[model samples]
Target: MTWVFLIGAILSETGGTLSLRMASKGGGRAWLLAVAAGFVAAFAFLTLALDGGMPLGVAYGIWAAAGVALTAITSRLLFHEPLTKVMALGIGLIIVGVLFIELGAAH
Candidate 1:
């Protein structure tokens, strides 16, 4: 199903982003390879989602926003980074925005 592909794209993209962070900390040949591979896999899965009937604008928009949100959360959890009130509010706004976009696309 298209939804499945979309979910895959979301996960892959998020993985790729996290891998970038890892690459940043790694700073060596293995990490460099990971960064390259992550990006390649991310785009590959994204293309499959798009081909499976997800509109480019909607799919990309949601993917980007969700990826950002999840990545932020993951970083906070893993790195003991501050999850301030303002950051939480911003994430809430992003969720609302995604809902609006999805609803608008439906009409």
Candidate 2:
């Protein structure tokens, strides 16, 4: 389904971004490979979702929102990064914005 692909894109993008961070911190060959593969899969899955008829506006909005939220949460869990109240609020806003985009597309 389109939703499945979209979710995959979001997760892969998140993984790629996290791997990039790790690579930057000297995580070496494995991390670099992961970063490259993750990004490649992310874009591939995103294209599949679009091919499955998910509108660009809605798909991209959801992808960006979910990626950011998941990344922030994962960062907090994996790296003990600070996730302040402001960051939470921003994530919530992104979700709301995506919801609005989806809703608007239905009309």
Candidate 3:
């Protein structure tokens, strides 16, 4: 449950950060709302996650890595950013690392 909440927080936070970047160029009202809502939801879920049993190290690691992966993907799709093979492999490794951390807590 805590890990779930942490993942949710990571997604929302990355989403909010992306939205904010889009809004920076001036998208008017809708983008502003998206950015605001995303950030609020991100922090709320993160706080809830901490209230659960998730360790700080695990939580932060997951949060940051997920954010980086999501942000990279979004940038590539939405902003025409480049993604090399090495970057993709690195992201894959990060995903594996997160899974390992989660699995470590199971026993």
Each candidate: what lDDT? 0.79, 0.94, 0.85
Per-model TM-score, in order, reads: 0.88, 0.95, 0.81
Best by lDDT: 2
lDDT per residue for candidate 3 within 15-40, as digits (tens), equals 88888888888877788888888878
Which regions of candidate 3 fall more than 4 Å away from where they truly are? 103-107
Q: Which tens-of-lDDT digit does each residue in 1-107 have in candidate 2? A: 99999999999999999999899999999999999999999999999999999999889889988999999999999999999999999989988988888889899
State the lDDT of candidate 1 residue by residue for 8-73, as single tens digits.
Answer: 767777776776777788657777677677677777777887888888888888888887888889
Q: Between 1 and 3, whose TM-score is larger? A: 1
For model 3 the local lDDT of residue 64 reads: 83
Q: 1 or 3: which has the higher lDDT?
A: 3
Q: Candidate 2: where is the Cα deviation over 4 Å? A: none
Looking at candidate 3, what is the lDDT of residue 6?
Answer: 84
Candidate 1 segments whose C-alpha is farther than 4 A from its true place: none
TM-score of decoy 2: 0.95
Worst 10 residues of 2 by lDDT: 94-103
Q: Is candidate 1 or candidate 2 better by TM-score?
A: 2
Root mean square deviation (Cα) for candidate 3: 2.0
